[model samples]
Target: MFDPQTQDQPLPQRLTRTLIIGAVVILVAIGGFTLIRDQFTEEEPPPPEPSAAPSPQATAQPTAPAGGDNLAQVDDWFPHSRTEFAEAGGVAADFAADVATIDYTRDDWDSHAERLGQWATDPYAVTLTTADGVAEGIWRALANDADAWTGSADVVEVTYFDPTSVTIVVQVQAEPDTGEDPTDLGEFSVDLTTNEGPGWRVDRAELLR
Candidate 1:
């Protein structure tokens, strides 16, 4: 509503008062509108923070077998090198196979003894030639009865090793010429020792079973 007293004022004073009142009304209306809008308006949530990426898993390294380092020291005090042990293992397996094999039609006791001696040390070789009761063993009996046999041997592993010797265990299988299935003669271990010449030779042999 317009006040009549305001019209009694001078024009400049009247104009200034009108402007001041109009400004005050405009500020009040703006403040009221802001408060009302705030009550009904929902504040938008802050933009979601980006999640961190997962870290990569570390790869596992292969662990060496136990006593692996000892292999490097194989020839330090040993009679043979690592390479020689491999050769000796093969020789031992061959000797074990020869011991298991018996062919009466092919080799006599003397010839077999000589063949065995080629791979054996003097002590072992002597036993092959003159060992009593060997002629009376099952193989000899089989040979006496006109039977022949064949055999094969596979090296299982080196059972014992040292500077002076290594013993290899083998699985021996034999089949008689009588159409029978091959017999598993059980395991045999051959001990090899460094001899006078280059490589290793069989010193002893034994049946595990």
Candidate 2:
């Protein structure tokens, strides 16, 4: 459908007008196709942000045991194995309990001292058996009173430690047969020598009260 006036134009002019209209039509069609594609085609999801790296967890520190000879509680035992530490702690605890407990009615102080001697050095053993020694004094005093007492000990902690020595603090509880409240003998600091004399023997012991 050509216009009569357009038909009458010169051949070059008519050709130019026809070409321009075709170009406009093509441009319009291309724009419409782009709009339709944008409407139907889902936009790709934005790239997921990389997750933050997990934070490093903190390392846990070693903790001391509440009581008993837990070998794991021994941190430093240079020149000695953990077995030695456990043995030393056990010997101190036993000595503390026995020394603080007495039964005057049974007349067993000699036997008790004999047992304790196994854990002491020769000189200390003599001290325990001597008439004027601390053990004898304790035995006589309790026997005179005719009172029986029992004791128990808990290894509170190791206060000092070295290559050949360690100091342990024990909590002693002495209860009398009269049924009164148990007496707290306070903390006993028992110093022991590992390399000298017997393997882990008490060198000296004193109350820290």
Give each model's whole-structure lDDT: 0.76, 0.77
Total clashes, candidate 1?
Answer: 0
In candidate 2, what are the lDDT values of residues 1-44, reduced to their tens digit? Answer: 76787866666878999999999999999999999999889798
Global fold similarity of model 2 (TM-score): 0.53
- What's the CA RMSD of model 2 in angstroms? 11.0
Which candidate number maximizes TM-score?
1
How many residue pairs clash (N, CA or C atoms closer than 3 angstroms) in each of the candidate models, in the order given? 0, 0
lDDT tens digits by residue: candidate 1, 84-166:
87888898878766765788878878887787788888878887676542222435545643367676788889878877789
Candidate 2 global CA lDDT score? 0.77
lDDT, model 2, position 165: 90
Error of 2 at 30 (Å): 44
